[model samples]
Target: MKAVILAAGYGTRLLKDLQGADEQHLQDLTGTPKPLLPIAGFPLISYWIEALRGGQDPIDIFIITNELYQGKFKDWAKNYPFVTVISDGTSTNEERLGAVSCLQLIIEAFSIDDSLMVIGGDTLFYEDFHLQDVVEEFEVLYRGNNQANLVLSYTCKDDETKKYGIVETDESSRIRAIKEKPSPPETASRQACPCFYLFSRHTLPCVKEFLNEKKDAPIDEKDAPGHFLSWLVTRRPVFSTSIAGRFDVGNLESYRLCNKYFQENIRKLNYLQ
Candidate 1:
């Protein structure tokens, strides 16, 4: 299987938040990309590399980044021989290809004919997340239906519902529909879907079809991966697996919280060991 980490975002929000910060902060994060941000004494994307490296199936990792940050990613990837960094030929967020387009680019560029694991470059799961377990569950689902794809969802507060793509699943955990940032009253489901997904090889062509149909649409409609998932659940057999939680490092506050959490968790683990 192949894993693609979508890191093409320019981290404009984070940069804006860092304005007027101390000299140390500015020097540390001025040109740093989101995925390359230091978390718990390690690069943010390196955590994903450690998690995915020793899995049963040999997985090749591909990171797609913008031209502005491609050099940084390539430098960080030197320590990880298995990772391939690709530039989407975009220097700024405004000119960058959307996440859906990035995914499609990796698909066509790599000629991937196998199951693909799509993960958000700026997001990470909680301790309860086990990659092997999730892959195994996806394998079982794939056995039952070759077109089945798995997505990760976590319960969020009602007020926070508008910030994420809420997934409504049936009793059997099959995704019924995905509501993209719907108001709390608009949907009863509080299951916020993250960017982690395992797509079966049989359903790979649907991604191209989605892009083709949305060719004339605005960038907002095709930018976030949730839009693609919201469009896909209806046409494909997508299922949901509940995870403990996820950290989406969008701005400075969120990044600080994620870093603190990881630092504490790592400290506790070392103490226990």
Candidate 2:
């Protein structure tokens, strides 16, 4: 299987939050992107690498970044020759191609044919996250039904529904529908769908189809990957698996929580070593 990590985002929120930080601290982070931000004394994206490396299935990791941070991502990839970094050729957030577009870009650029795993570069999970288990689950479902796509979700607070893309699932764990930041009291399900997904090779061409349909739409509509998946479940079969929890790391608070948990807990794991 192949894995694609979407890291082309500019991390505008993170940079804005750190605007008044001390000059040295701000200067240190000015050029550094979120995926390269230090966590547990290493780049934040390194955690994903270590976990993926330990998985049962071998994966050729591909990282998609922007022209502004291509050098930084390339330098980080040097230690792990298994990873390939590709730049989307956009420097700023305004010119960014968005996550869905970036996925399509890498898919066509590499001509990926096998099962593909897509993960948000800024997202993290607790120690319970086992890439092997997820892969196995996806394999089982895919073998039984080639059109199946496995997505990960975590229960979120009801009041926080406006903060994420929520999903409703049937008794069999098949996704019924997805609502992006929907109003509460609409659905009893609080399954907050993250960006992690496992797609069968048969479904890859549909990604390009989605982009083509949305070509005339605003970038924001096509930006969040969940939006594409929302449209996908209608056309294809989508399954959901509940994870222990996930850290999105879009803001300062979540970033600290992710680093602290991984450093104190994930770093001490026997398998991780």
lDDT (Cα, tens digit) per residue for candidate 2, span 1-273: 899999999988877766655556544676578888877777878878987898765779999999999998998899999999999999889998989999999999999998899999988776677778888999999999998999999989879899999999999999989999987888788889999999999899899999999999999988999999999999888999988788887776677687787789855543254
User: CA shift at 163, candidate 2, in angstroms?
Assistant: 0.6
Which model scores highest in lDDT? 1
Q: What's the residue-level lDDT of 23 in candidate 1?
A: 60
Q: After superposition, how far is residue 223 of candidate 1 from its true place, in Å?
A: 0.6
Candidate 2 stretches with Cα past 4 Å from truth are 22-27, 268-273
For residues 1-273, what per-residue lDDT tens digits would candidate 1 score against the true structure? 899999999888888876746667655687788888988888888888887886866789999998999999998998989999999998987897899999999999999999999999999877777888899999999999999999999999999998999999999999999988899999999999999999999888998999999999999999999999999999999999998899999988898898888887875422112
Off by over 4 Å in 1: 267-273
Top of the candidates by TM-score:
1
